[model samples]
Target chain A: MKIQVLFGTESGNAEIAAEDLAESIRNDNQEVEVHDLSSFSIAELQHDSLYVFLCSTYGEGELPNTALPFYADLSVVRPDLSGVRYAMFGLGDTFYKDTYGQGATKLDDKLTELGAQRTGEIGRYDASSWEPVGEGAVVWFAGVLEGVSATR
Target chain B: MDAPLSIAVIGSGPSGCYIAQSLRKALPQSEITIYDRLASPFGLVRYGVAADHQSTKSIQAQFSRLFERENVRFAGNIEVGRDISLAQLRSTHHIVVLAAGLSADRAMEVPGEGLPEVYRAGRLTRLFNAHPLEPTGVPTFGKSVAIIGGGNVSIDVLRLLIKQPEDFANSDIDDAMLAEYGQAPVSRVDLICRSTIANAPSDPVMLAELGRIRGVRFSCSDPIEVAEDAPRTALARAKAIGELLEVDPGPETRAEVVLHFGWAPVSINGDGHVRDVELRSVNDDRTNQRLGADSVVTAIGFDFDGGDWHGLGALKADSETGVLDQGLYRTGWIKRGSRGTIAENRSCAKTVADEIIADLDSLEQQSKPGYAGLPEEVRALAVDYAAWKRVDCAEKEAASEARTRRKFPSHEQMVAIAHNKLVESSAAQRGN
Candidate 1:
């Protein structure tokens, strides 16, 4: 299967996490493609493609600046993604209590509403803890790997 | 048009590196060259932060990777306002980012503020951290010291002064400065704030982390008086402080930190060196009190060193985008003022990078020679990444015997080392 990694970020944290995850999965001999959410094609939400969304919440738990277009289009177009399977990880600060990880949750909800099945639980990393997203993504990939195997 | 774009970043600090990192992602075909006035890179990481915070300095590991990129280069010892001109930068490179940071130290207009013993946080940090630009080897601050601010910089200064020399064994502190500070008569540091504790701008973690350092005792005066329109971040900080109050100081204390809230420095009273400061309460002016201290550090904050007097004055930084004007842009301190964590510069630089990426279509077509086109005088003086590595190796080598990481500690010596006149492993005589 061709794995797709999409990142949404204001500070490039999500993108770094995606790139690290994509490289690690590739080293395991799997084919992976990494993309910025702004450039990612929604039409690619088809069957037999594995997906991982690395996203960051900004501005009171809102979507990243570049991720807005994707969110708007995906929500409005509401593409049929019944065959799509994906996992998500969000970068947020706990100091932002009300909006913590809301961006990723919103996207996950929209994707699920569009008939996509999540491969595993969403991961949330806090800035106050000073956790580098790349470090968290590596551990989150294991659950994603299990989900992919079971579905296949 | 050539798909690859050439970029010039004026300052090799986190702000510059973050822009380079974002540009590599936003525009893959871009080539980034970082320039600094000093022979070293990683501006504040190398020279601004207190030396005791070694782990904080490790952020260089990530920045170092940016320099190794095939399309990236670090050019040091090149002054923009003097060695090169802003007009020259704009003519040669597609984008010019002024990440030089807030270079000027903001001093108060109060009387006697410029006394020999009084220092600003910016220059003091550079001096303690061993930046080549620091004027002298050791600044005299006899016995008691008073920092007139409640921010993290004040806290950092407090820790640097109160900590023992052995505490910096694994750090990159200047050996000479550390030894001087070690011998200084400094024993008590008073943090004078204009508002209550909650109103102070420093992170609560700063207050709680005192447990890690032995011999330092911290005592604050009342909770912060939360303002009606106090931002959410500050309110959150107050909540964090509520949590930090739970930590208890362990035994083996030596130095003491006394915090005076709701007090402002009215004037400095000193004949030659600092002797005393007259502090006035925030709510009332008549409530004047005098405190004795040999040294006073104005750890208030920093302002943009806008060289507007030069006609090419820098523009004000935008809240959302860092576009100063037309083709010229900015990031980091000069753009946003000296605030926010080091990591926050990533987002600030990313915003500036995105603006540049969007304007790429309208940018002037690729020019020949790029950085090589710099005037021969400036080009000859530029120190590339390889020379910086040698300087690094030399600094480490010099400190090897003391088992501490020492630095060139002076601009003249660093430039001399880059010119190959100073041996890497041997003690190079000080001065240019």
Candidate 2:
């Protein structure tokens, strides 16, 4: 199955995380492509590929600069994603308790509301943790991949 | 048609890197070189952000890619005004942008500020981050420390001093310095701010971290008012401070932190080292409290050192456009004074890049040699990106099991490592 690792970042952590996950997928002999959500079109959400959204929350739970246009297009166009299976991981600091990981949550909600099915549990990598994001992201995606395969 | 754009950016800090990133996107064929006096890149990320905040420092991975871009180079260990004159750089490059950030800490100017126990926030922070310029002496903070500013920097000091050794797992904090300071642990911290809680400039998220520090008791003299109509940030700050104030350290309490609002330092009292601090309430005419302190650290702010090597220190940029003069530019903390976060610098850089692009679009083409045009001796002094990478690898290789990397605390050591002289020096030491 083709996997799309889409990332939106303000300070580039999410992008780095997406790249790490893509490399991990490749190491497992799987095909993957990395996409920056800034230029990604809402209409590109197809049922054939599994989408993994890696997004970091900017100030007060807002989408990162690169993800803003994508999220806006998704909200306005409200594309039907009936057969789309997606996983999500948010990069955030737990110190921001109220708005922590809300960027990924917002995208997850929008996709679910538009009839897309989510696979496995939503993953999170806390910036406050001592664990490095690259390592933590790869570990999170392993579970996500297992769940996707089991569902298949 | 036009000569390929040649740009030289002074300082490899966030602002400089962001400017280079934007300019690379807009003018991919341009010659761009970022210079720093230190033999390293990512100025504050490598040295200013608290060592424990490794997540924030991870932004270097993005900036690191910028140094590897085609036609872009990093000229480390090169000081613009000292190694190569501003006039020389101008003659060599089509444009130069000064992002050399403010260097001097704004002095408290109170009597006894020069006491041995008194330190500036910038120096202390740099010291912990193992900045080569900062003295590596383990600062003595005997039991009580009084921080004289309300910014995030002050909180950073408080966190560093209060955190246990275990809290720094995988962090690149200077272990030797931390161990020496840990010998005489600071048990009390008095955070003094001239403004009210609502007006303190520290982010609420930063202040909120205080509540999470294990085994610390917090108290506030000023009432934390979360007014219904207060601004969201102010309200959040008040709530955080209020929550911290309610924390009960219990029987196993490790330390105590007291927050003082609406108070200004009158004097630091000590003969040689700090003994106590004198403070006055802004509302009252009478001189008020004297808290016994082992040391006093000021985090008021920063200002440029009087030597304006960048030649744009006059703040003469067109306020609306950010253009100083033809072929001259400024950005980052140096451009707008010492303020703003790294994220803000990215936007500021984009704006300046836009300005530079528009300005260059109108100018006539002229052949300009960028880094290659510099004198052989000056260029020889630079530790290029690859050499600096060697230093980086050496630092990581030298780390203990707990730390991510052990930074060279002196310029000599880093230079030696970068130039592959460490092996020879170690062999010499062994012979001795």
Candidate 3:
């Protein structure tokens, strides 16, 4: 089974993390495809069983510049996700309080609303942390592998 | 192994934060506090770097870690000389590192420069970047602009004026200002200089970066060219100054960036507002010319104002190893004069840090109470890191869907939101 990794980033932080995660997934001997959300099409949802969103929230809870097109198309057309299992890892700074990691939650909700299965919980990483950067994303990915393997 | 030492770093910008981070690494137990006049960190980075340069602004993420440390603290809305005197900080902390970067613009001293339309590049930069210190909103620069001095900053301002609103969609530039700039009838930019292109303070790389921007034709009064077989750096600069570099702008092009080299502005003349920039050639004949310009901007260097404010006088200290004067030190632009970029401050700061560590044993120790020593009234007025975060949330939350940030340009407005949150939090606490 092929796994797809998509990322939307403002300051290139989430994109770097997505690359790392993609490399890690490839090391697991499973075929994986990675793309930036700006270039990714909503129609590609039918091609894969496993879909992963690595996105960062920008300016309150708004989507990154690259991810807006994906969100806009998904919202207007309301793509059918009847058989897909998806997971999300969002990068955000809790300094913004109420608006932190709205990207992950919004994506998670939209996918579930369209009849897609949630393979794992929405993982949100606090940008304010110093020790072991983006450790939350790694911990969240651990939960995802179990679901992906069980489906395989 | 010893009692925690107190250290105060003035200016919560890149230099100040770097000092805190360096000191923390050297002395993990040291209590570090950063002070700023504004209710925000990343001083100039917030109010300096071009809006289009998101990658450069990303340096703040690295500085953000210093605030989260148990030993490090942010004390906002405090001026060292006014709120608490320089003497007070010296008595409170064992070490006080003054990293308050240059705040004043050097006067051009040219005739008619005193006109209202003629302004400093630093002032314009702050106004555009939404500096809290700059109470004034964006000033109007009319259809034609004449920029004096040739440097990266001159290129930066030119880039800003020529860019379309769509280019700023992903940037933290003021969305309202973007809308205002969209309607600006700006069609020409004249870069006035008193010397040859080689004498210009800006780098070849910066000129190359300016070249990459789309939709702008280039020309010069002189036949701009570099010698054959010039180095890569020289070749890039020659090409930047010589070529009419642009990307597929149809018809007559949107705007033109014309270089007026070897021409010194003799006067910035107008009736009550800017009308033209009068110039004299650097040649022996001293030819005179006047270009019709609605606005004139001086991009000449910055001025250091620390010593004049405090009783310190000139603010110069030996930056070789360290100043090594009564636990006082200086770094960044203030130390070496405002010349190098952000990365240059790191090495200079590290050298000072080494000196600080070397003298730690011999230096007299004091049981100082950093920000905690501030009177309740002063504390109330100061915006702490948490309160700033609330203001940050409010600013971001207020932005339009397509915009990156809705900045709190007015210092008064930011202070209101920051302090109001504190009042509500305290009121709720009393009820509880």
Candidate 4:
């Protein structure tokens, strides 16, 4: 399946993580494309067969600078995502108790509200830990592949 | 097989740590040495960030994790230009990354700057954070503190000065500084912005925080009025005066601090000691005001100290080439103008690093002895990567024991620790 990995990163951490995951996915014999959220558009996202969203929550649980406008449009415009299957990984520090991963959670909730199916549970990565649990990404990809195979 | 490439990074600040981390993961075999001017790492996080912002300071934990890698070494108290020269770095390592951040603050250049009470926000923040400069002594917060500027730094100072002990306890403020702040009889603080409230550079979070101050009242409408003997007032002064007028002081009570906006200091009235500040209205609008305060702090911003790098010739370069000098790179406030939040620097650094890496493969195609002209000073030093790691461990242990973040007290301490480690290693080598 063609997989699109889009990332919104502050300090380029989530972007690096997305690139690593994309490399892993491609190594598994699946086609993968990675794009920075700043350069990627909502309209372009419609073409992806499997969507993976990796984003970091910035100040006060706000979206990263590059993803702010896209997130704003996604929420108010209510774009249809009927054919989309996606999963989100939120990068944040647990120290911020009040607005923990609010950026990614909002996007995930919005996509689901727009009728998109969440392939698996959202992955929450505490940047304070500084380790990516690839198990979550692997399982989500497997689920997406299984769905595609069943449909075929 | 060829030997793995070795890289030396000067200044173990955020950019340096990030560069080392990226290099370690991308090129695992490559050896990395992170050299800092101080014994401790995490430059701005340890020095510049306000003590009250513990949530932001916690990001250093991630950096500490990156340094834990076997291939990475931390060299504390190694001043690049002084202890090690550019020529020496080129000879010892295949590549050298300069991630040293800006060290000095920009000046307001107004007439009253030389006044006894005049201070810079950068220095003030550093002093309160228990940075090496903190030992000098905390600044006395007079009856009224007028902070000039509406940026995050100004807001940070305001919050630190005005917030009570309970608010500060939840954060990681240094104990001594906290006590000093508590005893300071400063009651009124005036934040002066050049423009209207809407045009202020303060972030929404800071604005909200300012609004939440229980004992402090904010005035956006009132401006300061200039007395005949007072200095000229800027537009901000007009707004402050309007706000101050609205405030009702109880009988036998006065606002402890008055934040004067709009009036830029034209001259100092007193002889060597600052008696009063002469003010001028901004834009020559004729509306003037004078703040009759004993102390003043110019919170304009920071500028890069380019004097040291002047020998590098055209230190400036196109976005594609990193720095004009080969093997040299600039990032963060040093690369671009001082603007944007901390996260913006990541992209800036990445862009420069990518440019250097792109040229790397091509340069290696026509390879020669990389370090042909070694500087005499760098060649004489017996310091190595392993010795640096020992000093790093010692600093981290000390910080952990103190239940605080890592800190290098002085330049001398850092070098002494590193030198001792080098001697110990030599002794062990002979024994073995």
> Largest TM-score belongs to which candidate?
2
Residue-wise lDDT of candidate 2 within A88-135, one digit each (tens)?
A: 999887757878999899989998999999888889988767466778
Q: Of the candidates shown, which would achieve the greatest lDDT relative to the real structure?
A: 2
Instruction: Please give the distance, in angstroms, between residue B130's alpha carbon in candidate 4 and its true position after superposition.
Output: 1.9
Q: What does the lDDT read for residue B194 in candidate 3? A: 77
Task: Please give the lDDT score for candidate 3.
Answer: 0.74
Select the stronger candidate by DockQ from 2 and 3.
Answer: 2
Alpha-carbon DockQ of candidate 1: 0.16
Candidate 3: which pairs clash?
A: none
* lDDT of model 1 at position B84: 82
Worst 10 residues of 1 chain B by lDDT: B423-432
Candidate 2 lDDT over residue span B340-432, tens digit each: 567778878878998998898555467888899999988877888999999999899999988989998877667667767765673353242
Error of 2 at B335 (Å): 1.5
Of 1 and 3, the candidate ahead on TM-score is: 1
By lDDT, is 2 or 3 better? 2
Residues B1-432, model 3: lDDT tens digits: 255688889998878877787798788888888999888888877888877665556667667767764457888888888788888888877888888888787778878888887878888777667676666655668888999987767777877887777666566786656666677747888988776665566655456555555666777777565567755445556665654443444565778788877788888888899999888888546569999998988887777754474777765533454563777887777777777566567667777788788777765665677677777767776888887887888987987766557788766667667777454554453242
Worst 10-residue stretch by lDDT in candidate 4 chain B? B364-373
- DockQ for each numbered candidate: 0.16, 0.30, 0.02, 0.30
lDDT of 4 at B421: 40
TM-score of chain B of each: 0.88, 0.92, 0.88, 0.75
Model 1, position B363: C-alpha lDDT score: 79
Task: In model 2, state the lDDT of residue B329.
Answer: 84
TM-score of chain B alone in model 2:
0.92
Instruction: Return the clash pairs for model 2, or none.
Output: none
